[model samples]
Target: MGLKSSQIKQLERLYRRKIAPKSVISSQLVKDLCTAAFELGRIVGLLVNRRGSVENVILGDATRLYLPDIGRIRASSQRLRGLRLIVAKPKKKQRLKAKSNMVFRPSLYEIDHDFIVDLEKLRLDLVLQIQAHVEAESKKASLAIIADKGTKVEYFRDVNNISFDFSQFIAELEAKITSQIKKAHKIALIKGERGAAILIGVYLKTQKAWKYSLNELKELCVAAKVTVVDTEVQRRLKLDAKTVVGQGKLEDICLSALHKGAQTIIFDCDLSPSQLNSITDLTDLKVLDRTMLILDIFAKRAVSRAGKLQVELAQLKYSLPRLAKKQTGLSRLTGGIGGQGPGETKLEVDRRRAKDKVAKIEGEIETLKRQRRLRSSKRHEKKIPTIAIVGYTNAGKSTLLNALTNSKVLAKNELFATLDPTARRLRFPKEHEVILTDTVGFIRDLPKGLINAFRATLEELKDADLLLHVVDATDQQYVKHSKIVEDLLGDLKLLEQKRVIALNKCDLVDSEIAHKKAKMLGGTCISAKSRSGFKDLMAMCSQALWPKDIFR
Candidate 1:
């Protein structure tokens, strides 16, 4: 890494040299750059803007060079970065073969894959590599530019022979990229949705699990009304410590997202604070994990005051520890009820204020919980059995309640469609009346903050006499879905409670298969949408609630 004063001065002088706007590089400039690299025994690189003025003079070891932080490409813009990179690499005489005419092949100077990564990731105007030789007559260079899907590279036998107008070449390349992006995003524009995202999943588990997780992420994105422009999945032995997905895959994802006009990156797995920080730093894009996306959906779906308070509490608790100095994501949560305090630094102030808000919200939620407890006592006094319907999200629990009571409770075929619990009184065929309650749906790996914040609402489940587990009959992953609900119930210590599994959506599958599935799981088959199995479902519920009583 040692540099002589003469070498340092020569490299510094490069920053003062101006290139011709119409040509890639002048013959004299190329000769001087090659001479500097040959003397320093290292690679010399330059960052040149479209005006043909040198912006930076970079020094690197033989193989790799690191660029300074140039800000991100604006997501709204569909053009190149308007800057190009030129590098001079000195080669040993043994690595270069001597031809009959004493000239080496231009392929020796072909662009490296690392440079290709830079070309796509930075959206550079172009990248040029010169194979610096002691004999100036034998120097060769290669040029690369952005193509439709990847990069296009060309080689020149002589670095000094390039005569094309660099400015005009860059203009046409940007126009092509802009036109393709417009065509690709036309449908999203027509739909008038603003947030466009790319979904990322890194899995070491079974492929089925991976696919299911990614599909669930997609549904979450849909529930949030984000336009999914693309999805990238990596099958790895284990998650990368820093990026979750490896750095290479993440770079490819950024390039794809950049080309597809996506402004956000949504991961299928929950991210630790360090992973989130590392990922956001690498791409400079809005980064969100499964938990953040779920919390956001809860924020949007919450209607009741209690529900809203619970959602805000969950968001704050999840965001407090993750508040970094450079954090730009999760602004909605960090901003809090009152805006930033005057004269207080951001990171420390956000954590302090969020803790205060969490305490206030917790107190409010506890008050609501006490009120709910009083109501539960009244039901207990009347000797009315309570049945709480719980299942994986979008498993038709709300629809089943609507079908049984003929009351609408905002039933939609989306995840977490019913955030606030709804209760209705329904009479069995035997005229035995019971209070049926619908609670928030469950999912695998539910965020811990969500579980703690919604504990008040879920407390009612502990008092219920029977747990009606609704299973989506049509899903190929129904067994796994049932297991997830059971696992959650076990975590809540409600598994010991009497339970009745009703396989909902039976009409969407074959009747024989549905019946077999119900029999296998020791449950009843029913269609919440059609109400076809209402009688059997009621019989099962009545038998579970009043086993000693005889029913007609």
Candidate 2:
């Protein structure tokens, strides 16, 4: 079709006002004109005066244009400034509606009026159809441009052709977007209530064992008010002596921590001083092994002065060895048997301070131990029976104590929730009364430093008339936990004492199953939350503590 008189006038105005003034037409303006013309269902060409001798033509829809005589021609729009616009006619007439539906309705209206209405409807429909076709072709071209990877590829005429793999570009863009999202998520988590930590474990055991241990570590972290974002576990026949994990695994762990925005790395097992240093140095993140994590929980949970002293003493003892190990120069100082001339380094000074702090805390603990003994002696004079509640961490010991004495203690589901020992009086039948004390919970690999430092508090156990070993019946590792507590009791030399086991958390398990487990472990099933089966537990305690008495 030919251009209308009005369209030609508009084009002349555009050229005079926007195009003719510039010596060279901008590539953007060329692209705009081409896109507009193509949308209007017209193919256009730019005829430019090149060097005033020959005319050069630049066509829209570059893929349809061919130049057989030119070898590997490159298209450029920089020199096409004083160009005349050329519009090509459509190859075929576009149909507005299906021909089968068209019919002459002579009886409906006057002939001229009906013909005009039908022709206008057809014209409107034709424009809509052309717009739809243009949109479909545009989408197809975009997809082709994105998917093309061959050595020779055609690009849009107005845009620069940059040789690159579209697939690789899209992949890299997606990765960058995903990384930004993760970083924002991590920042939100950090700026919220809790800090983030990554848990790492190296185990020679089965996956089940690793899961169990790592879960406990996670609980410990929770109790300390730290969020564990991720965990990494490696299974090997032997653990790496320096970093606990192999070098490659350590690097992976570091990268994972960085990606997760974790500020700390927690190990499942205790690390030696040298191992801790090596891992921290490599990761550049604060590293804490299982023992130190437990100590941190205790430090946060301890409320009483005595409890705080015990925790500090343990921490100082643990740090002393690390401090000594940090001073590699100390070995040089001890070169000869009689050579003692070198002065103290900063590490030595820190070690000395740590030792002094340990001594002060130990002396305070001894004084407290003495005071505890005197109190115990006074209770013994009154002939009052005493019962101690002991169990694994988070096994509901504090809940059991609260249930028995009707006193509220900090009973939480997290490990090491209650660090300070709590004591309450429980009155039995016939005015018989016994003092029940709740001690710190035990774990599988309880730190030796903790045990030694808490001796002042644990000394209360030695004078007990009977031991109430509380066991968590609902724990999947209940049996292992029971063994751990029993082993610890044996180490404390309280195994020979009169003991009664109260299978706690029976509310979480089937009654029959709990009863069976209690029987197998020689315990009485009870639920602290529901206060079920406590009468039997109390009767068993009475028999064990005051056998042959009328109260029993």
Candidate 3:
């Protein structure tokens, strides 16, 4: 088993070529700056929609319940509106010589050619054997590498180029090279509200957050420091795998990720564990599907007792089924906090124990739910017209809730800052008291685990008389945010309830921009930090929920 010089092998090399080489190009500063900018864009792509390809399965016209790259697509468009996402598909055609087979016999001089004829059969057999070998060799395989922990573990890698070893390079990088080709994500087809596709890494500048109307969503990313690659409303695409805007677009995402040295990818749509694993297996990067990102946000934003428990519950539930197909690295729960517990290893170690723990958590969550139910009953008895602040995560709902009531809710500039519901009674202009409840911030992709765990808390919104749908007016993809909230609300049957879109974070955008966005979204613009337009917003809510008799 030796390599011959005739074979050509591509090795992964760290190209240190100066961005603008002094020999041919000019200033190194420009080169360095441009290189830095390029790197920043690449990193943003990796952070935002790390999964280069997206394939969504729309369960209903209102919301995308299933995405191969993401688990769920919460099109939070209040009343849904007329958002049409067209996904173009290539026309299929049938081939003429479809099941053709051939039988060949060598022709030669009768007697003299007998030996040559036999030789031809030998050649044919050898060709068949070689074809089988090549096919077998092309399949994916695993590689063992020694990590910094001094632990030797086998990581799955593509099997390409393994059969013909290039002793010139180490096996690991070679494995990565093959793996990238086979599985490396190139085009991250992320969808915004309305099934709009956003390919961040390939086209959009990753360094910048989603701006314009997307400010609200952008702020969430900035607050969470989560990268935003791209957001789109795709109309047509493949249903089977769901990766790529299409095959060609997928190729582009893979190429883009490869060019920028991105080892991770994301999709706006939430993906199932199997979908996630399959994508990761193809892209060779840590695929952070939409649900994973939302979970990450929840993990980062969770603060209270119930919040932590709910987050843990959701994480465990979302994580369990995906357990069947996890990366080897995902199994190790050697660390703390996020990956501290049994983790991917738990699936390998003792699945029954993990299952038992999930059940125990469910039981505990039920107890919590009962407590929330008791609280809801109290509110019901009071007959108070409760106003629940609900909208896309990081839409300044927390900040506004804090400003209005001075309740000091954790209004950090982060996504999903308030996972648990917090309520406070506030006096209106007429001395009428109403309970303002801040529930979990909604996102385009909310994991089922989280929804299930936080049901007790979310039930607040269901019973509420009015919903304060906060929108970050400054974010570029605000429309997308609005849609996510709408879809989730619809899923909860809250859209039929009275609601007002409180466009928060108006300070980030100019008056002109704010005015237009407000008009388009049918939401009033205000900044919680500046305490601007609070009066009008309050009046709007009071007017919507309060009766003329109460005011009189």
Candidate 4:
């Protein structure tokens, strides 16, 4: 970063030099560039527009070149940035001396993979790198451009001999890229409206559950209508304080996302506000963490006014900390005359508005809670036993409810398909009826804010005369899934409530295996889709809810 005044002036002069647009660079200019970098013993970079005018000059350490922010151009767009990068790095003599004994002579240098990533991520027209050496014969150069598959790289043995019509080459390259993009677009049209995403996971060295976490994250993305293109994982003793993934890894991910035409990056774990800001600052790709993805799904799936309010409250509370980032020009004095209040900064005003909105939503939810309580009281007066359906998300809870009550409640095979609690009357042959309520499903590491926001809805579980715990028999981690649900119930102080475990989706598993698993968990095997074992499930529920009616 340190440069003498003369060196600074030399770099400033680069902006004044113009070359013919048809040529990549004149041999004399290349010599001058190499000479400057060789003298400075650092990497030098130039951002050149298509018209052959230098826009910016960058300096980096001996090993790498750090380009400045080039503005937010969507990487997935079918266009190229009207710019190219030319970089030159000084070759060290000690390395050459160490390899002097080799029978075959080594070339000066090769292009860095990071630069190729930069080329694709920035959608640059092309990238050229020159290895500057003191001896003219040892100097070499490399050129890279976007190709049909990924990137096409070509090396020049001697920098002086490099010659190409830059304008024609770039025009042809862009044409090919446009054709490829058109083909890709037609394919995507047939695939429905789903955005592409990359999944990222950062875990401590001691953590071995990352695979399951990522698997669930992928499911969450699918539920949110996002198509996952690839995944990245890192193991660290401790996560980076700023970006959860280290800076280098974050850059690599951004580049990979660009390469795959992914529009979003989803982290498997929840991110702190500062971490989110830090990561977003490094790339323009849309960034989301697990909590945000879940909140988005809830916002989409909520069908009732109360459900919508609860989700909005949770999102507002979750984003309250993110608004702490400083905002410019919000601190202007608004009280021109006798207004007695201290003018609030824009940041303070934004936080105040968010807090007020959250309070308003919470108040509305309270009103809904009272309405529910009134209805609950009327049911209490009727002396009907309340049975609430609860289980891990996508575990056939809604399907089971529909199978039992014959009511249409938007049963889908996606996570959080039903957000609002649905109630139906289950009448028995003996004139005994129970209030069956289908509540929202739970997941592992469910956001705490969501839990607190849905308190009014979940409170119904406390009043539940019996809890119908449904388990997905096909899940390999069903035991762990059950434990997560139980732990959440324990947190809500509903663990002591009477419970009946029903292993749903038994038809999908082997009959013997399903029965064995049901026996092991002290539950009944039933297929919510096929009605198999429903009799046994109902018998167990009746025994728990009305022990005296078990003989009936």
Which model scores highest in TM-score? Answer: 4
Over 4 Å off, model 2: 1-194, 324-342, 550-552
lDDT of 3 by residue, 1-552 (tens): 132332112100112222111111113312332232232221100001111111121211111111123211211111111111111111113244433474332221011122112112111100000001121222222222212221122222322223322222233433544444333233322322111122322223243432332443444444444444444433342433545344445544543444333444555455656565565545444566556656766777677777788788887777777666445566465545666555546456555666788888788878877887788889889887799988877678888888999888777766667776888988887667889988877765566677878886787787788988888887667897788889988887777999888778888888888988988988788989999988788778878886573332
* Candidate 3 lDDT score at position 126: 8
Every candidate's lDDT: 0.86, 0.66, 0.52, 0.85
Q: Lowest lDDT 10-mer window, candidate 3?
A: 123-132
TM-score of 4: 0.89
Q: State residue 361's C-alpha deviation in candidate 3, in Å.
A: 1.7
Candidates ranked, most accurate by lDDT first: 1, 4, 2, 3
Candidate 1 clashing pairs, residues 3+ apart or interchain? none
TM-score of each: 0.88, 0.66, 0.52, 0.89
C-alpha RMSD (angstroms) for model 4: 3.4
Enumerate clash totals for all models, in the order shown: 0, 0, 67, 1
The C-alpha stretches of model 4 lying farther than 4 A from their native spots are 1-17, 35-45, 56-76, 94-105, 112-121, 133-139, 148-151, 178-191, 205-208, 327-342
Q: How far is candidate 2 from the true structure (C-alpha RMSD, Å)?
A: 19.9
Runs in model 3 deviating more than 4 A are: 1-275, 278-285, 325-350, 382-384, 507-523, 550-552
- Report the C-alpha displacement of residue 344, candidate 3, in angstroms: 17
